[model samples]
Structures are given as structure tokens and as C-alpha cells.
Target chain A: MSRFLSVLLHGFWKDLPPFRLVLGLCPALAVTASANNGLGMGMSVTFVLIFSNLVISLLRNVIPNKVRIASYIVIIATLVVIVEMILQAYFFGLSQQLGIYIPLIVVNCIILGRAEAFASRNTPFLSAVDGLSIGLGFTMSLTVVGSIREMLGAGTWFGMSLASAEFEPFAFMIKAPGAFICLGLLLGLMNAFSHWRGENVIQK
Target chain B: MDLVLLAISAIFVNNILLAQYLGNCPFCGVSKKLSTSLGMGAAVIFVATLASIFTWLVYYYLLEPLGLKYMQTLVFILIIASLVQFVEIFLKKFSKPLYNALGIYLPLITTNCAVMGIALLNIKHEFGFWEMVVFSISSAAGFTLAIILFASIRERLFISHVPSFMKGTAIALVTAGIMSLSFMGFSGMVN
Candidate 1:
């Protein structure tokens, strides 16, 4: 249906929260040392997010107003546990590399933000679609950032050498500071692109 | 013992804010004034230590044995959020000034990676019950030290003539880079 298509396309450009609003920068910066790591982390968050949105959407009216946030958090956390267990059991290497970040997803503002903003008000099917699209947008952003860092810092893409020893990697690119620089630049570039597009101007 | 090593490392070598980049949302957000940063750091120290303690117990006793270790992250997050809510309500009821100073920062604490990081690190190191307590305390202290120092820097930064492009987060991040580099000096102290 046209409604579903609108939701899916919105995630790519118009309604992309992270690219536009900059809500969840913790995992956006911390765990993005590699493409695989970013992808793995993103997919895990997507899984938790979609399930939580579905559940929250289903129980929206039944939940009491006073305890809604608490109830939402409980639902989100339960889903995180399920995805985390499966990832650890099957994708052990990623499970190890991601390390504490897997658990850190609970604090990722994107998931919680969506739960509060969209899912609580929408139907279950629509909520799931929003979760998937928005999650994919986040995943794309992480991958791009990770790819840039990995390529420049280590002269590799996804752990394979892309540049030779003749090139001296900017060691800072792999460090914590690099995360900020990369993210800031990325945000600026995204802003510049949107301006050039000259379609919809959300504030700077 | 390793506990002592962790304490030293956390304080000087691997501070959560300066080195590991945890708790940076508040670090950058609230570090404009020295006094406020100190207050925020103190609040974080109190909450992070307590949260770490409780999450560790939950992980070791409940989750690990029951083959539900994956649930640790989600459960830990819920625990921290609820704990902050509880702290906020209690403070509002008992003390006005305390609540006002810390009230806004309380909700933000739910996502301050340092709290979650301490819990995860406790699990990763397989720290015993007592060691978790020590690690959490030292880590919290280290976070306080880093933020307060950074706050002092920002106070100075306000007066300094910064470049056009590097005014806000750009300069703060560069300062952190320098801080991280300096902290690297302490690496030899551990080994």
C-alpha cells in the first residue's frame, strides 16, 4: 500500500531521526570500529526495536498511563535479552567483538525514542515498519562512519587491507576522538547535502 | 591484587570519560561551569556505584546460573532507569535543593554509558562480589575526576580565542584527545 511505501521511504531520507535529530550518538560512535561490527550491532538493535514496537503498539491502550514508561522499558529489555542470547550463541565472534555494546543498546536513545514517539500511538503493523525503516537508516549511518574510520585508520575495509604501508594511517581515526570528528563531519555533510537538495529544510 | 590495579588504572590510565569516552553526553553537555560539573560528577558517582553493585549481583547470582546471561543488558538497563526514577522521587520528597540540582540529570543518567559500562566490565573481568564494589567505586571516582578536570578546561576555553570551526564540540573533542594522550603516560605505571 502507499502508506507502507511512505513509511519505508521516510526512513531513508525524510524521517531519519539519527541523521536529522542526532538522538543516539553513544553506539553511533563507540562500537563503530569496523563495518561488520557496525552492521552486527545495527541488526541487533533493529531486532530489539521492531519487536518492542510491535509489543508496545499492541499493549498501548491496556497499559496504565502512570506506569507506561516503566512498562515500555521492561518490554524493550526483554526483547534485547532474546536477541542478545541468539547472537551470542550463533555469532560468537561478533558477540565478543561487540562486547559490552550489545548490552549498551538498552540505552540507545533511538530505540526508546521510537517506542515513546511512534509505536505508542500507532498500530502494530505500522509500528513494525517504522522500526525496520528507521533502524535501517541508523544502520546505514553506522556503516558509513565505520567504513570511513576503518579505511582511513587501518587502511582496511572490513579488515582487509585497502591501502599499503606507504600510507601512514591517521592513528587518531581509530581512537575515541576520531569518533567525534567523524560524526561531526558526517552531520555537517549530511546537512550540506540536504541543503543542496533544497527540498525540505529541517533546521541546522 | 587486581582490584588495586583496576583502581589505579581506572583513575589514571583508563578513565571512563577521558579515555574510554563513556558518559560523554553529559560530559560535553554539562561541563560549561565548574561547579555544575562537580555536582553532576558527584551524582554520577553515587548512582553509578550503586547501579554497578546491584547489576553485578543480578548478573552473577541470577542471570549467569540460569543461562540467561543475554538478558543481563536489558535487565541492567531497566534496573538503572527505575533506580534513577526512584532516586528522583526520593530526593524530591526529602530534599529540595538536592532534587533541583540533580533532577534534570537523573533521567539523562539512564543512558550514561559509564553506568552500563561498569556493569559490563564487572562481568567481563569476572570480578568477585567485593571486587565489583571496588571497581565500581574507583571507576566512579575516575569519572568524577575526568569530568571535573574537563569542566575546568571548558571554563578556560570560554575565555580563550578559539578558531571559527573548532568552537564547541570540535574543540572539546580535541581537548579530550590531548587528555587521552596524557593519560597514556600512566600506562607504564600499571605494567
Candidate 2:
């Protein structure tokens, strides 16, 4: 039970997708212009991650070692297709907002990384929990980044205008450079915080 | 004339790495040194162009005609994975020196979103064959340019003093952010 709990909680901070592990950065950087977009993208990825991890864990014993990576890719790609169709059907506006990044989730390293590292070695239930925790962690990070960007860039949080009408938005926060710098600074802050707590910093 | 503009736009205005946020894993992971970044850039240019062409053909000739457009993400990924493997084997057999330079980066290309993203973008933009070729090549060139420039800067950063917490990826990302800001200046050059 402790092992399961540790696996579930680790993704929140210790192995957080974007900040700590530094995986799946493409989608993390893109589709984060607005808080809503970030949440939407994160949810899509969580769905794919949870199912892929569960399926991969269940089939870990059966899949040939030689072709495990390819098999994993196939499973991940199929789930991404399902996500794409579902998003298109119900979340048309958000699907358009996410654009290519949605499909690009197939190549997102976080899903593949977890499948190869955790799911393949663990049991089905544990792997599913890992996926949920990691996926939610990823979602949380994206949402935070998105919220910061959206608030500063548009003077709103998740499309809600929280700032006064006289407040002028910092447009750069929504641009390409803003995404990089924002994430970079946030990463630095996380590391600093961890360092203060006497934890080993994320090296790379 | 329009082809030239498209090429310029892809390379500078809409850089695959700096602007579009594709292939960042390699951009951050393999960009520690100048030599390796150059090798990665070359590998990306080569594989991305081939993948784009193949994916373009597969989409237009196979998926579109069969009305299986929804299978795009799945099919494109498989094609890219196999193509990278084939390229690795073919390089090893035919051109030893070429293989040595780019061999390590080939496997990584399978998961590089930049290659797959360009392939998807080619279809999304509805580009003809020649247009897709030009766009892919230029986009890869753009990726190469960004990484090479970034590596050069990062080499200097090694000797410089950085805060302990921001010594590695954090600093690298901040540098990339500034570089991306500079790249944004070229956005006005095309379109």
C-alpha cells in the first residue's frame, strides 16, 4: 500500500512531468497560451496516459521484448486518435485551439516514458494509479503555467477577467518567448524551493 | 516566388523549434555541445525531409483515397518509426562515415515531434508535393539554425556563474526564451 501511495504521489512534485522529469515539453510549451487550453490539453493527455499505462501494464508479459517499443507506440497512437475524435466531436472550439498539439501527443515523451519505465515493470492497478497521478500532475502544471500566462497576458484567469479594466495586459506573456521564459523561471523557482528543503535538485 | 516566401516563413518566421514548440526534447537534451547539436541538426534535416515526403505520399495516395483519414496519427507514426529504422540500417551498410555522424540521432527522430509535426502541417496546409518538400527542408533548416545558435551560447554559459538551482535546464530554457524573443523579430519579414 505504501508503494502504491508513493508511486501515486511522486508525480505531483518529485517526478512532475514538465518541471522535474522534463518530458512531454512540446505540448507543455504549446497549447498553454490560455488556462482553458492548458487544462483541455492536459485532460486529453491524462486520458491517453491512464489507458495506455493500464493496457501496457496488462500486456507487459505478453509483448515481445524486441518489439515492445513499437507495440507501445501503436497503443499510444490509437488512444490519441480516440482523443482527437472525441475532442472534435464535443470540444470543437478547444480542439481547434489545441490544433496540431493534440495529435502530437502521440509523440509526447511522458506517456512513452511512463509506459517504458513504470508500467512495463509494474502491475495493472499500480500502473493505472501511476498514470492518473502523473497525468494529473502534468495537468496541474499546464494549468498553472497557463493561468500565469493568461492572467498576465490577457488580464484574465481561465477567461475570467480578474484585473481591473484599467489594467493593461503584458502581451509578451502569451507569445512564444513568454512560454519558454515563464516555464524556465518557474522551473528555477521549483528547484530553489526544493534546494531550500534539502532535496536533490533536478539536474537536467 | 511564393515558394521562396513560404520557405523563408518556415525557416525564420515560424521556426519549428523556437516558434512552433516542436522537437524541444532534442533541442534541450542534445544541445549541450556545439558538435552534437550540429549532428542532431543534420540528422533532423535529413530524416524530417524524408518523413515529410513519405507521409505526404501516404496521406494523399493511401489514406485520403481510402477514406481512412482518421487513421492519420497512427499511420504516420508507424511510417516514421519504420523509416528511421530503415535509414539507420541503410546508412550503416552504405555510408559508414555518414552513419557515424548521424547514427545516434536517428533513433531519436522517431519520437521527435518536429518531424511528425511538419508532416501533419504539410497535410493541414494542403501543400502540393514541391511545396511540401520546400517547406519541410526549410523547417528542418530552421530547427538546425536554432539549435546551432543555442549551443554556441550554451558553451559560453558553462564558464559563467549561474545560481545553483538554475544551473542546468532552467538556465537553458531561459536562454532559449530570450533566443525565441529574438526570432520573433523575423515574424514581420514574411507575411
- Please name the candidate that would achieve the greatest TM-score relative to the true structure: 2
Tell me the tens digit of each residue's lDDT in model 2 across A1-204: 899899989989899989999888898889899999999999999999999999999999999999999999999999999999999999999999999999999999999999999999999999999999999999999999999999999999988889998999999999999999999999999999999999986676
RMSD to native, candidate 1: 3.0
Q: List candidate 2 stretches off by more than 4 Å.
A: none
- Best-performing candidate as measured by lDDT: 2
**What is candidate 2's CA lDDT for residue A177?**
96
Give candidate 1 regions above 4 Å deviation: A1-6, A14-19, A192-204, B65-67, B152-178
RMSD of each: 3.0, 0.8
Q: What is the lDDT of residue A137 in candidate 1?
A: 83
Candidate 1 on A1-204: residue-level lDDT in tens?
A: 999899777777786655564566677778787887888888888888889899999999999989888888788778877777898799999988887778777777788889899999999999999999988887887888889988888889988888977999887888776776677666556656765777555332
| Model 1: per-residue Cα lDDT at residue A153 | 84
User: Candidate 1 at residue B17, lDDT?
Assistant: 71
Q: Go through the candidates in order and give each one's DockQ.
A: 0.39, 0.89
